[model samples]
Target: MTLRIRSLLEQVPDRLDQERFETWLETSALRIERILSRGHATPAGEWYDQPRDEWVALLQGAARLAIEGQPEELDLAPGDAVLLPAHCRHRVSWTDPDQVSIWLALHFASDGTPQPGP
Candidate 1:
């Protein structure tokens, strides 16, 4: 099969009224996705409780993330990242309104600790 190459920064919609999630790859135990947000926030009183661990990185723009039990919300800029353990309740508190926020997220089995591939 021929190898394919793509750019993440290209082909993004010019405007977003709601957050968008695009899955790039997936397996039985893992998934990789790209998310786009513009002035997006989780609904009031809503939180995400996932069964898998998630590692998310911001590629463009900025955002705020609030986690359950945390006293302060996390402000993330380009290149910033965080790992959320399985079942960790969290939500997007805010995203840049004038610019699109691009994020790369990886989700894997709760116990699939990352290790170097041989």
Candidate 2:
């Protein structure tokens, strides 16, 4: 089998009307993705409630994450990481508009129990 190698920071679009999601790997129990966002945010009042747990790291730029019932949004800079458990409501509140914000996200299988938020 041929081995393909690529950089995560390569091939970014010059202009983005919306956030771009690229799945790099997937298995029966896990998935890895590269997400690029610029001046993007979740719509007002919309939240994501996923069935699987997620570990997301900010590889470049900046962002803010808002979790349900949280008094304040979590600010993220490069090298920052957050683990979100299944059924935990969350949303992207902000992303840097001047530069592309790169995120490496890993979603994995989780038990039926939902985890509490901070």
Candidate 3:
């Protein structure tokens, strides 16, 4: 198979009616995704409880994240990142309303370690 080269920031959609999620890569125990958000947030009284650990980085625009049991919300700008352990409840409080927010997320098994690809 021929290898392809692509740009992560290219061809972004003009309108984001809802949050966009694009899977970049995946293995048996790991997955990588690119997310685009425009003034989007998790629903009130709802939280994400995932079985795997997640590491997320903000590449552009801005966002706010709230972790369960934490008093302060995490304000993220370009280049900010957070690592959430398995089952750690969290939610997106807000995202930039005037511009699209770009994010890179890595999801791995519950062990909090990245398994090597075959």
Identify the leading candidate in terms of TM-score.
1
What's the residue-level lDDT of 15 in candidate 3? 78
- What lDDT is obtained when candidate 2 is compared to the true structure? 0.94
lDDT of 3 at 51: 88
| Tens-digit lDDT track of model 2 for 18-103 | 99999999999999999999999999999999999999999999999999999999999999999998889999999999999999
What's the TM-score of every candidate structure?
A: 0.92, 0.90, 0.90
Q: Using TM-score as the measure, what is the rank order of every candidate, best first?
A: 1, 2, 3
Instruction: List per-prediction Cα lDDT, in the order shown.
Output: 0.93, 0.94, 0.91
Model 1: how far residue 95 lies from native, Å = 0.2
State the displacement of the C-alpha of residue 118, model 3, in Å, after optimal TM-score superposition: 27
Clashes of each: 0, 0, 0
- lDDT string, candidate 3, 4-117, tens digits: 997778878767999999999999989999999999999999999998899899999899999999999999999998989899999999998899999999998775455653
Clash count (model 3, backbone only): 0
For model 1, how does the per-residue alpha-carbon lDDT over 36-88 read when each residue is reduced to its tens digit?
99999999999999998999999999999999999999999999999998899
Candidate 1: residue 12 Cα off by (Å): 1.0
lDDT, residue 15, model 2: 76
Model 1 scores a TM of 0.92
